[model samples]
Target: MSNGNETAKGMGRRRGPMGGRGMTPGEKPKDLKGAIGKLASYIRHFKFAIVIVAVFAACSTVFSVIGPKILGKATTALSEGLMAKIRGTGGIDFTYIGKILLFVLGLYLLSALFSFVQGWIMTGVTQKICYQLRKEISEKINRMPMKYFESRTYGEVLSRITNDVDTLGQGLNQSITTIITSVATLIGVFIMMLSISPLMTLIALVILPVSAGLISFVVKKSQKYFKNQQEYLGHINGQVEEIYGGHLVIKAFNREQDTIEEFDATNQKLYESAWKSQFLSGMMQPIMMFVGNLGYAAVALSGGLLAIRGTITIGDIQAFIQYVKSFTQPIQQIAQVINQVQSMAAASERVFEFLNEEEEDQSVENPCDISKVTGAVSFEHVHFGYQPDQTIIHDFSVNVAPGQKIAIVGPTGAGKTTMVKLLMRFYDVNSGAICLDGHDVRSFNRRDLREAFGMVLQDTWLFQGTIMENIRYGRLDATDEEVIAAAKAAHADHFIRTLPGGYQMELNEDASNVSQGQKQLLTIARAILADNKILILDEATSSVDTRTEVAIQKAMDHLMKGRTSFVIAHRLSTIRDADMILVMKDGDIVEQGRHEELLKKQGFYANLYNSQFEETVA
Candidate 1:
């Protein structure tokens, strides 16, 4: 739950309103071309669909662009007929005007139909791409090395799957159609305006640079504010999640006022940046409109002069003005599309980065069969470190015959649990080998190697399911009676039955409804149900009360019979009856012997045991 803050922050960084208009500008891809190239490769299979969408978009824009010119014909006829009637030479042509109006309406309906088809196809393509990316990312997570997860926050990884992929999807859906339609509209509208009057078309062309300059200026001014807003939003999100998760701790320490102050500070910054960005972005439309009006006024003035001189018809002037308005709109749409492309590139890069991370080798060339392994384990000069340059377990060596109860006793940071991890191959040793039944652990497939052993750690893990289901997780094919038998063996059956629904009782996520001791007991039952040839218990009894611990120790002794068991215990009293006690310090075993003999030697183990005895006496 402590990781909730990191997840919130990651989400906030990429969070924005849909359609790419208000996306945060905080992140940009380092290699824009490369990211786009990779994204292009992903959609190459859908190229045919994209081509269809582009054709539809062009058709839609072309029909829309031709509407004004066709409409102008009707206007010309009506005006000429009215003038003729005033001079008593002719009358209005309502029939011709009606035909022109109906034709224009058909064009518009076709345009809308084309637009819908393109939009629908583009949406399907975008969703498919997003789905594929998410699927690959999910598969990648399982194959990724543990070190990668340990080095980064879970939220950061999750954001690549959720936020980054979603941003990429939305950007693709909007940007592709937008770029196609906007460009088509620009070309078609320009051609229409030129046909009406090159002089008015030229006058409209001058407005492009002015409108572009204003848009550029606004984008430049608003970008920094957008970045600040995104940064502060992430900060606020992280702070809120962190404080909420630990509110009880804050309350216990009487730090509510401090938390409030911190939250206020972040909220204030978010408000400041958010308003500034919104204000600047909001100014763009009005600014463009102002520049557009200047162009419109100039065109209208020029068209009227040409009209009076009979250089162009009144209908031409009307159509040219409409074309001029249509022309500036595509330019604005193109500018927004550019922003969307940039955002898309940034998001795709993040998702690709995660997808390309190094994956663990989950298989071997010819895996050894461990099904019949008798668990004769040995570590021969094994060496390892989470980081290669800083070795933790140095020159470790040990051997255990089948069916030995081996207790590992040490202070914290003495590589006790590390030894168990090595045996299980959670991490492979940097040098030498850990072997079972004279075969190196690496010789077997990771799954086969792991299936031979069962583990019960100090931290019990139970998912959101019924108690019966959680216990059944140990051996998925086990029967309900076998599950109950295992639970009885671990002494968990009594408390489980006392619960509201007994075996059917559901545990919430984290299993907070149960006491710490109960959770530990449930895990023990799970391990017992697994009934592997090798068992590793790392402080498995540390959570239980004194009497429960005694009962559990007896259960453990019974379960460990005729199996290779490695027990790591901080409480020296718990492992006194073990067949062998190996005392470790600073990643090396300092001593090893039966408990009584080790105490008689008056060495490190004896001193540790004496300290606990003194504490008990006091």
Candidate 2:
């Protein structure tokens, strides 16, 4: 079946558990409670800010309740008493009316002050949580194995760290406070209304449940759209990130039109889904308000009649009308806040999924602390693979003494690099053992074992920094003089000196400011300065020009001395003079000998060498 058919089938299956399978959402979904709990746990880290915001919210609610009650009471004073006529209560009683107005004015001032505090507290909480989650995500990625990265895109990972986390921030901080404050305001208004007239309150609440039920029904339908919107947005973010990073590749392959069409398709779907969700959610407030006001009118009409029949005073009826307005205001607020809850639940699931991933095994429980390592390597029946249950290396064994140079020769996918990866502890062996100086590699600490080798790869990634800083990356504490010396040793200084500011020269994104050859040599300089006892060059010169290859090879000769060096070769020219060469096939060493011995055997290595030697002559 096609991918689209598979995706449709999967989405259909997903709805069964998400309350999307003909299920009513009378309460929060079971999964949602856990998501809410996780968000609350993360939110509790900023308890001081939460407390400050809660206090401000409480002050605002108190002012709201008092301000309304006083205004109503001052209105009733005029109709109920001779004090209403003698003091002409409604018209400026600068002494008494002024006091009432002044008290209301004071409440407004306090409300404004607390509102500003609430805003600041909420902003701080969002920023702090976002910062903490971003930091945790970064650390988590570092711990994950290469397998996780291999199956995922740079774009997808980027979307999770950026877009998804931002969505979570909106939910965790601002959304939590919005829902809490709105609910609190609703409860406060309800109590005030009940105190005024239980009958009138009952009349106002009669249609409220129906309005809530309809608003909830609309939200339930739109929740699926919200999920779709978020999923498609992640896809869109991934696609856009890909296009921007690979603009040159798209332009080179004449794929611009196809790429643009793809982007438009993604963008349009997101636009439509977002529009549908927002439009549906937007309709909720107005419909609920309309129903609430209908109840409000009923309270006013019926209460006014009770006052005329002398069953209740005009003051009590007037107070009841004002209380009805307060009660309805909070219902409108509650309907609006429900969206925040739904959005956070979706984001929390993603964030937690990432955090819960199994990290790479770093279990060297009894780690040997090495003061100095004199590179001695032995592969005793060594076996390895990048994945579980898939053995790449079978009965592979070799011995390299200190100061020996070894070259590994193989085709593209013959596990040459995989062997190198194993040696570096980027992966552990499937079976057998790799040892250094008669100690199992696993017996030593990970950093110490890795620190024994300085490695250079085919593709060099230069961070956003200066020339000196990039070179200093190998040993962060290395001085400027040492950085320049390493650059000189690797033949990188000549080109670097030509650039503006020499050592201080800045590298743009991915070191695009410099040529590939320059970047490679700078990486070599980084490895050289570290001065490790072992060296690994994994097709390091394969991607560079002949001249650059010559530059790196010359540097390799100097560094390889007195160190066990493993160079995985693509060009046969470099391995002819090596002390030993191991020809690999399907993760096994098919042949191993000196260059002359391998050439006379006319085995796999001989054919590869002859083909390359012939190509050189031709």
Candidate 3:
């Protein structure tokens, strides 16, 4: 099968998802041995249990392997006794035949018992490994820098955590036992076949090259498509998630047909890769079986000739036939195990890539404590960029006194929210010092520094929980009464009281049950409850009506007392009473003053302020 990626590339379109960022297939790890070696470290903890499993697997396969040979003895004895009775020499040895039959039954039962125990042990080992992997991924996600998430799609990260890990665990569970059992059976069956007839053994050996060639050819042809299939699968999942999350936008914009076209393109690619992979990989078993039958024909013919020549008995020929059947069975199983291992290796590469991401530096060696911070903040000659080559914030500087309300107004992408991000230390400045109170912010622990500030963004976030619980998330120890007070202060208590279950009403996923404006109010209540010395409000009232905004502004006016607050807003009218206004454009502060002072200047801030009114006039 041809690689779909190469085909797509040949068509001049890059191999990726759809119109948006494509999730092309992950490259195979350059170091397969190293990747597998690291995976083994996770397995090493369960070595003792795995060793026990191996012992049982080996014993089970051995017992099963010996059964056919031992049963051949019974067949030979019965045949000899019958021949003797036919010659009128002696009656068949019925008691001896019964003893051999009972022995064979015992062997089969012992094999079954060992096989069952092996499976049970392996199940426990696989589950523990999966648990460890998931736990590590969860922790890794927390430690990862913001840049990592910004660069990768959320669905891609989630796929690593869920799909890749599951594949590794499930593949190991099935492949490990099959590998041990198949190898042991192959070895034992080979020895038994040799004992039965050397000629038959040689005939069976002829099938090995043919089977190997077929499997190798199919695997080589299909491996690339399998990799493509995995990538497209992730792309499909990512597209579906994006569409689902922004379905309202799609409908509003009449992008339903465009979305379907993009999805169909991705789906078409997925289908091409999937069918080709399945078709080629699936051809293995049937082809192997056909070759095995040819070997079987050859073996039977040789065994019959030997039997007629009195070189091998009919019972021995029968055992050799059974051995031949058992031999080919393990070869097929081994082929399957190899495929599973390759897939596991692919999955492990993704998991290891996540595990190996550069985590945020969280050292607290020279940490400064800000438990009693007074909310004075300063940005000293900050220089930074999201990308190294493209600087966004250039030599920006600002200082705010305690209990001051500063409003940041700017055009979109004019570095408005970026200032808040810098203050919160989400992304550190390339060269500068940000200080809280009198101490450098970097000197303070990230957790402690963030604890001093309360942020309410335009995009409200409420998890699936009761209204009370979502509010309480701000200050976990807050009493129910305290929560109600905070809600009242944010002008949300009246609405909450009217709900069917009041604070107990469950918020569904995405909190779609509540209006966007209501969600913003809850977030404001959360900020109020946090009671931090520093507050950052980013378009906090953008979603609410004029009446609601007035009420929210009144509540916020009370909340802002005795606290240093930074308000980022597009509506300059709301920030009229701010102690100071910093008008920014292209990552620089072009004008700064109180609203009245800036309006008199008639600069960039004036144009920005006047444009809103002009748009309204139009």
Candidate 4:
């Protein structure tokens, strides 16, 4: 992570767990119950199927719970029949024993069949839930305003879609089944044990509180670590994503060692929390088993004494012992299920938080059709800022006549791009309104408002595709001939034709196969193909060499002939021929004039223009 105080503050600002900020998600959101309720809303669509699954699950657990008791009957019959044969004239009742064994087998098979059906239905239910969640999240991403994404890392956002949703789905599936089955089994086993012998049941129940206490202790201790594990995992993911994306920068600046150390620190933190949570949660089974053994011993001793006193039959004693053993499993499962639910809740909170972010205010009460809008645009006394207390653009105003070439020039943080963003309504002005052809920009549907203007930004974004396809992105319905013509207009056709496959040549990811200048040319071609009445060129020629820049400038001149154009440039020379120049400083226009007039005034624009010449002379 960078040590800049602003960056540090951003990383430390609390949002929630997986918030890409600090450690926790502030507070637990109503704990497990709240998460379960939210998840239930998604699950309600499959209620009929879930209900059937619950029915089958209950039936299966009932069968399983009784199987051991029935098998004990067979054991008793065999032992009694053998004793009869050894004692005197009678032989074993083989037929009766066979019948008991067959009944036990049938019960087990039915249990297995019902369990399979339950699982089969649950698989579909869980997958559909995940599908719906992911679909909604995908749509939500599109509707989310720029501010939401700006506040978080890309990895954090992606993790909500991938990791958090998966966790919710998987946890819901297991927790639902486990809760139903475990509770049913625990109830059935307890009833069977009490029927066999209340004394033995009481003896077995002795371990319940101790086991519960142990489980509660482990869960409470482990949950904090689990939460920490999740936070650290997100931190590590964010760090890794940032580092990998800037691998080139790291190498160039020879900051590889610093990057690695930072990654290792975050990785080490993740490892600690991950293992600690795992180790604590993992101890549950053994501790429960030990308590189970103690219960088993108590049951054995009490049942033996009862059998010797002829108070209970051998078969009943055998069934009671099996119940004692089976009883602990469900309790253990229930404990683990609780843990699973807690983890699920943590994940659900993050996922739901993202889904509920404030979307773009897209309401246009009286929408205007922008299809035939004139190219004239005006900003009147605009006051805006990304945050409430820190206004960046104040009392800003501008008016451009149709077909005028207006150049905005200023220092780096002079609200240049902010002005462009306001013009496009990427961010609405806090007070004033931007108008297009005498209509407030916000009065038009956002999509309609954006269609009248085409933009080529400083960053040249070309996805992995054929050169022709990339250019055609501006107007997806454009024909190949139109694409080629647009390329020619941008002075990109000559170089593109020189490639092995001409226009069909495939660009790699990041478009690293072409030089930065060529990438800029392709973007220009895209804008040309768009053929909108208004155009924005934000340092459109910055990447190209002087020769290419001159050619591109000529092409842009032709493109902007009858269109309203806004050119934001740091290189003062390029905008010298603009129809009007608006010189800005600290969000306000300090000077607005033609090139010759601004030079004669000897104001900020003159000094800014002369600085370039002085630097070249030096």
Candidate closer to the true structure by lDDT (higher is better), 1 or 3: 3
Best by TM-score: 3
- Evaluated against the true structure, the overall lDDT of model 4 is 0.82
What tens-digit string does per-residue lDDT give for candidate 2 at 1-618?
001111112112221100111122222334667766876887888888888888888777777766776766666655555455567663434466567778888988887788778977898888887888789889887677655655444555666788778887776666656665666677776787777777877898887788778877987877766665666666676677667767787788888998888778777877887888788879878887788789878998988877777776666677667777766776676666667556667666667777778886565787776556677789999877666787878899999888789999988788887776677665778789988887888888766676787777776768788999888888888898999999999888888889999889999976888988888788888888888888887777888889888998887787677778898888988878798999999988999999999989989999999998899899
The segments of candidate 2 whose C-alpha lies over 4 angstroms from its true place after superposition are: 1-31, 77-95, 264-269, 310-322, 387-390
Q: Estimate each model's TM-score.
A: 0.86, 0.88, 0.92, 0.91
- Pick by TM-score: 1 or 2, better one: 2
lDDT, candidate 1, residue 546? 98
Report residue 504 deviation for candidate 3 (angstroms): 1.1
Model 4 earns a TM-score of 0.91
Candidate 2 residue pairs that clash: none
Clashes of each: 0, 0, 1, 2
Q: Report lDDT (Cα) of residue 543, candidate 3.
A: 77
Q: In angstroms, give how far residue 555 of model 2 lies from its true place.
A: 1.8
- Model 1 alpha-carbon drift over 4 Å, by segment: 1-28, 209-291
lDDT of each: 0.81, 0.75, 0.82, 0.82
Model 2 vs. true fold: TM: 0.88
Comparing 2 with 3 on lDDT, the higher-scoring candidate is 3
**Which clashing pairs does model 1 show?**
none
The sequence of per-residue lDDT tens digits that candidate 3 reaches over residues 1-618 is 011111111212222222334644434445666768989999999999999998999999999999888888888888998899999998778788899889989999999999999999999999999999999999887667666765555566778878888878888999999998998899999999988877789889999998999889887777667666666666677777767777887888888998899899989988988888778767878988999899999999988888889998878888889999999999998887777777677678778878998987765787887777888888899888989898998788888899999999998989988787778776788888888887888887776777788877777778899999999888889999999999999899999989889999999988989987788788888888988888887788887899888887887887788999999999888999999998888998888999889889988888988998899789
